[model samples]
Target: GGRGGLAALRDTWQPGPGPLAEAQAILADAGLPGRPKVWRNRLTQGNLQLRYGRDARWYRFTRSGTEWRMDGPPSASPVDLAY
Candidate 1:
């Protein structure tokens, strides 16, 4: 059997403070919606905790803000994208 989703995310996702910043920049450059805010924790496999506004939701890597489909998108709204 394989590790659970959260375990897999914790094992595979390596978003250092630097790389994470760069990823955000890429998102900004691509003009994608939603902001990558504070990283809560690896929620599950193929999903991560993205803080936006006063809430945090789990989102997959490929899912975009507009495609979130839920009442609110899953990406984070960090205080500073340059962080």
Candidate 2:
């Protein structure tokens, strides 16, 4: 899943801005703010995670078909995450 798949979303992870609006929308619908202090990729295909707000917790995001979803409320960012 690293060759392409959702990994391509990193194209917006540059110094300026990122294309997380759509991804954020998913979080918004779940009552989670659409902002992140840090964004990182997961070795799992079509999966991503972020840390936001006052909590240093990490929330997992998964892609199903063409849509992205929140794995649940923010949990601690695991030490094993790829990035």
Best by lDDT: 2
In candidate 2, the residue pairs with backbone N, CA or C atoms under 3 Å apart (3 or more residues apart, or in different chains) clash, namely: none
Tens-digit lDDT string for candidate 2 (1-83): 22232333333233212323333444444433333333443223234554232233333556678666555544443332223
Ten-residue stretch with the least lDDT total in model 1: 43-52
lDDT of 1 at 44: 14
Over 24-77, each residue of candidate 1 has an lDDT whose tens digit, in order, gives 554455444455454533221122233222123233333345332222223443
In candidate 1, residue 52 scores what lDDT? 23
Tell me, by TM-score, which candidate is best. Answer: 1
TM-score of 2: 0.32
